[model samples]
Target: MDSTALDLGEDNSLLLVDDDEAFLRRLAKAMEKRGFAVETAGSVAAGQAIATGRPPAYAVVDLRLEDGNGLDVVETLRARRPESRIVVLTGYGAIATAVAAVKIGATDYLAKPADATDVTNALLARTDTLPPPPENPMSADRVRWEHIQRVYELCDRNVSETARRLSMHRRTLQRILAKRSPR
Candidate 1:
């Protein structure tokens, strides 16, 4: 969504879900400062419990959680609180994952390192609403994986070259591609 001006309410409550304790705490504090009542969960179970009981007006979910994948969290949120706007965040930021999040009823998907303003804006933009999740289509993960492999090949399997072309770091590119290859 465009980062246009928004009028956020003081009564709006936000649920921040992420495995990273520091990140979650920092985000909660920031959102609280922006007049949002914020609560945090470090695992999918805790998040689901809170969601089922008293859903917040907004949710910020991480792609990976210690208990399970964030997609499960999305499912739970949609089931219990369809009115709650949900935004998925990930450091990976793969296209396939982003598309999947949209398909699964997430209002928006954001990459990690996004600041409090970014998160606040996302929640505010979703005040309108969203549709329900559809039946599972073919996940784009395979296609994305293939594309990444092709890029790695084009870079002659060189992490530095691949990172340069991908506009990412050598280690980050290597880590992303390593899942497909053996250790």
Candidate 2:
């Protein structure tokens, strides 16, 4: 209708996945009206199937699905179709989850209920900076901390075996423990 709208037409192909049937249909139609060649899937399995068959240029994945977490779908799509940009959406979005998504492989993360324009911008903006996704946002440090905390609870704060199981020197584990304890 306007020049800006006309300019937005070129990048359109998208694969949209959500568990809510009505929401999925409405989004599909809205994206279509905006010139996207949109495909809709109501479950993770269906979305994975569609992606494997004919991968789109981008994807919009909800955080939770009827069958499973949408992160699994995102992982599958990222593995099978690396070129496809991914934008993760969640109705229960939090800072940690949003950061994790972005750090993992998402081009962008949105808090639903996101409008059609919100979705489009995220999918389209994938081109601006193509950073390689981190191998794991939950880094070894974080994992070690969690493991130590778990072992500490199980072993009643025993420092020896936790360090052994964690495959680190007792001194190193103690240093980590010191950080965790109150100063």
Candidate 3:
């Protein structure tokens, strides 16, 4: 089935909040083409501002932002529009965070590299069943690399801090970060 073909009607307004400027722009354009009135924000504060002014019917929020957690924006969106369908998108997806997001009112939690079709399905699904899992899931090494990268980012790209948090030697962390992500 073409998930993107699901028409949310003329009143289908959406807010997309992410720190990646290029990704945000592309996703906004894609969503607009798919029949949503799209508004974009690059931070939690900015998202909150737009949402407060006019709450969207749907929202796609990133888990990490320059200013704050996307959950903060999700909370505000839910407060403003109790019926809003919110989806939390994250590069650093974790079971704990996903559970927290759902508990706080998000309709779905998706990992990064999610396309417009995935977002639409997440926003409009009537059932709890998630989209089919990826055919080829990441290998253990690849997942470890991704997690290390996420931690590095969260630590403001500080090698020492990331190493300390991960309980690894600084040089080892540096070497891992320098290597290309595992396939």
Top model number, TM-score: 3
Question: What lDDT is reached at residue 39 by model 3?
Answer: 91
| Per-candidate RMSD, Å | 10.2, 10.5, 2.5
Q: Give the Cα lDDT of each candidate.
A: 0.79, 0.77, 0.90
lDDT of 3 by residue, 1-183 (tens): 352445686678899999999999999988887888899999999999988999999999999999999999999999999999999999978899999999999999999988887888788888556577766878999989888988899899999999999999999998998889889
lDDT of 1: 0.79
Tell me which of candidates 1 and 3 scores higher on lDDT: 3
With a 3 Å backbone cut-off (N, CA, C), the pairs that clash in candidate 3 are: none
In candidate 2, how many Å is residue 12 off?
3.7
Q: Tell me how candidate 2 scores on lDDT.
A: 0.77
Q: Check candidate 2 and list the clashing pairs.
A: none
Query: Higher-TM-score candidate among 1 and 2?
Result: 1
Task: Tell me the TM-score of each prediction against the true structure.
Answer: 0.66, 0.62, 0.83
| Highest lDDT scorer | 3
Model 2, residue 114: displacement in angstroms?
Answer: 0.7
